[model samples]
Target: MSLIEARQADPKRLIAGATGEWEIIIGMEVHAQISSRSKLFSGAATDFGAEPNDNVSLIDAAMPGMLPAINAECVRQAVRTGLGLRAKINLTSVFDRKNYFYPDLPQGYQISQFRQPVVGEGKILVSVGPDNKGRFEEVEIGIERLHLEQDAGKSLHDQHPTMSFVDLNRAGVALMEIVSRPDLRSSEEAKAYLTKLRMIVRYLGTCDGNMDEGSMRADVNVSVRRVGEPFGTRCEIKNVNSIRFVGQAIDYEARRHIAILEDGGTIAQETRLFDAAKGETRSMRSKEEAHDYRYFPDPDLLPLKFDQEFVDKLAADLPELPDEKKKRFIEALGLSAYDASILVSEKAVADYFEALVAAQPDVEKDGKAAANWVINDLLGALNRSALPIEKSPIKPEQLSEIIRLIKTGVISGKIAKDVFEIIWQEGGDPQKIVAQRGLEQVTDNAAIEKAVENIMRANPDKVEQAKTKPGLAGWFVGQVMKATGDKVNPQTVNIVIKQKLNLED
Candidate 1:
């Protein structure tokens, strides 16, 4: 179902806000590391998991005479991401110094975008649903700006007993800081926004979208006010890595703000830290403004501009996005909205599904049935094994064959499950495996009649019970299948059992 159908089904329940008379306003500032070979302004390697300081360059460490130079690939990637988000790309933008103090920040200032960003005035659409049945509500989240920035070094505190260490491996790395307008109204919306952002960046290939490795992070801005009232004082929750934690931080911070206001206390404007263990936000520092950063144009680097032709070419090469693919799946492939939604949720899964569908046979094939098997049986097994679709031992063609076998009644459901297990582990032609193992269902009338006769002779009392109580016929069918090792097709067993017992259809 679409979000519209869901809302119409239960308008009051799903739309109800926990704040009662208050509205929870949320915006997120996401910092995604640019996927490139080198840092923004330095020649340092942008590889992760390297030795301390191995990826650092003289410019990254603020050497006296080192000069900054832009990475063209990083710039192109940032622009690509902006275009993917439907943001307007600025023809020109400047780099500024964000002055700050930290042990790992040897430069004492960070190169960042201020006043003018590379992208502006865009929107992202977010939705949520079950495997496929979940409804997608189109929440138009406004993008304020997307700027290019350089990340600071990492301070490692757990390395030694007393002295801490700094890892400059990540220092000077390129980052795209995408800021959003305060349009979200609840924790669910916050989650939806983050998820959609992750998908977009992943699709754009601007970032790897690996939250666990800190390739992406979000600074959640949350505030609460009485319904229809002007926005309240917002607090910034910094560096929330996971989508689930982002939603939790928003919920916790909004409630904290509301409690403070209800108790006649003013909500403080500050930066806070989310403790995943406590599930709450705690004060970090007073929120800094642009003046605190001492904003000024960088003397080492000049203003950046792009060739219009190059950008147009890049846009032309853009791949199919999640929304577009979902729509086409429904319209062209005749897939249900829910099914399409599931296939498009992740790029790899969608690719896998499409590859199988592309090779689908025209004769005696059920496209929707094939989709159901892929979605439920195949995906369920993959999840249970803690593997991705790419890692599944069962190839698309193999799974497609299994679906065909079940459709042709060449095997019973129980027998098909066994065949799937074999294919999942042994990795062979599914039909050959079924043949070698004698796994095909015995659907012939004579075979089923023999099994039914043997079952009735052994259970004469149960046969009498089934004749009197029609529902008890199913019990006789189960006995016959058990006696025949379940190779007998279940439907055929049911037919022969009913015939033998003189039970009406």
Candidate 2:
């Protein structure tokens, strides 16, 4: 069944309690680090894994009389990402000071966007559930706004016995806080929405979208209410990195809220932390309102302004996005929705598939075969070795050659697998491996006929049984294949055996 069909069959993920069913409402604020070399308002390096304070500049450290200067590249990246999302590009936006106190924050106030943001009112279409693999029932999640802000540093509490160390390497780095409206109804939809957003930022060359390395993170807001009632008090789950953890946190939080509301208890408006180890959310502190931040325009920096032509140029330079590429793969390459979706899930995988198709000009003939090899064989080997697609040992040209050998009947599917392994380990031409290893398929009609004859002669009783029970022909085929060392063409063997046994008609 399709994902939409499955969802329709069982609509609500209701919480069973004494009163009745409860509905969950969800929204997300995703913080994506811009893919730039330097920090937002400083010249410090933005490289990950740097030693503590090694990359911090005077501006990053907020030294005396150090003024913040905006990074033009960061601004361009933010604009490019906005255009990719089909968001409204405000020609003018303002940066404000968000007052907060933390040890890792060198500046007492964080420079961020409040009243005005660069990107406004966008939407992302996401598909949820395993059954919706290729065919997406798109749910349009509304994007409230995308604003620019500076990232704070890290605090290390486990390094010392009593004293904690602060690392300012990430301080003053540019972050795009993409806020979404409370359109997500389930954890599944929230996960899909995050996946879609990550793809867009990565494709735009704005964010790396590496959740493990903290390049991107999500603050999930979850609440529960009785059916047809008002929204409940929401709790914010902060900095859930992994997509699986995001879904889990939401599910746990929604149920927690429902339990409180049903037991004559009021849910608290607070910020919580997702404990991945325990699979539960613990309260960090009470959630603060906008007024609590004391937000005001920063006097050090001027308002950001640009012209329409600047936005147009950035839009023009965007590569074909995931949606566009997926449609092209389906329409032009004749691939199923599932196959196309898998291919386009990652840019590297999609590029490799395209290169393989380009290597062999007969894409119309070999496209589906190439896709199968990539998704099944190539990806399986890579996963087994725990290697990314970019580090794959088998080149696209080599894979294309392997597919061609199978299509041209030079090698059977089984033999091609052996060739693929050899190319992966030893690194040589697929055809050369086949030729040198004597892996060529045996298509000699007479030799196959003799093998079939010998098999039938040896297993006369089985052949007699086959004459009565036509399904027993498979035994003869398997015996012939084993006798020929599994190198014989299976189709030819089947045809010759059927002719000998008079099973053809």
lDDT of each: 0.83, 0.88
Off by over 4 Å in 2: 1-12, 132-136, 363-365
Deviation of model 1 at 481, angstroms: 3.7
User: Residue by residue across 271-340, what tens digits does model 2's lDDT show?
Assistant: 9999999999999999999899999999999999999999999888899998899899989888887888
lDDT, candidate 1, 387-450, per-residue tens = 9899989888887888778878888777778888988888899899989988888877887898
Which candidate ranks first by lDDT, i.e. highest? 2
Angstrom error of the Cα, residue 96, model 1: value is 1.7
Q: For candidate 2, what is the lDDT?
A: 0.88
